[model samples]
Target: MSVLYALAGLLIIAAVVSLVLSLLGVIVVGALRILPVVFVVLAAVFFLSGGRIDVHLPDKWRRK
Candidate 1:
């Protein structure tokens, strides 16, 4: 009976971990999907602001 209880606890732990991981994966994917749109909007705002917005992006994101 003790071993069975231990196994049940392990199963519950595994299920919880899996649920958390899946939620994280979903959030990451959702952010990635919206990233391009975010960038576009930022770019628009930057240009409209005449470089006053200060996006502070990486150098690679800048055009030569």
Candidate 2:
């Protein structure tokens, strides 16, 4: 749980930084380059967690 949150946070930070850099023309990371990073991160999460993940939904969204 904490690990997933941390990983997600890091990915979001990296994406924001990447976007900022691209806008500044410091680095040109097009969509093609970004896709691999997303896939790799997803693969890492799935593999490292042994493909088991539990998601909890709020009561408001749950089926009665």
Q: lDDT for each of the candidates?
A: 0.95, 0.86
Best by lDDT: 1
Which pairs clash inside model 1? none
Q: Root-mean-square deviation of each candidate, in angstroms? A: 7.1, 19.7
Alpha-carbon deviation at 44 in model 1, angstroms: 0.5
Provide the lDDT at 31 for model 1: 100
Residues 1-64, candidate 1: write the lDDT tens digits.
9999999999999999999999999999999999999999999998888885455789998899
Per-model TM-score, in order, reads: 0.78, 0.40
**Where does model 2 exceed 4 Å of error?**
26-64
Question: Which 10 residues in a row give candidate 1 its minimum summed lDDT?
Answer: 47-56
For candidate 2, lDDT tens digit of each residue in 1-64?
9999999999999999999877867444565668889899999999898897689989899787
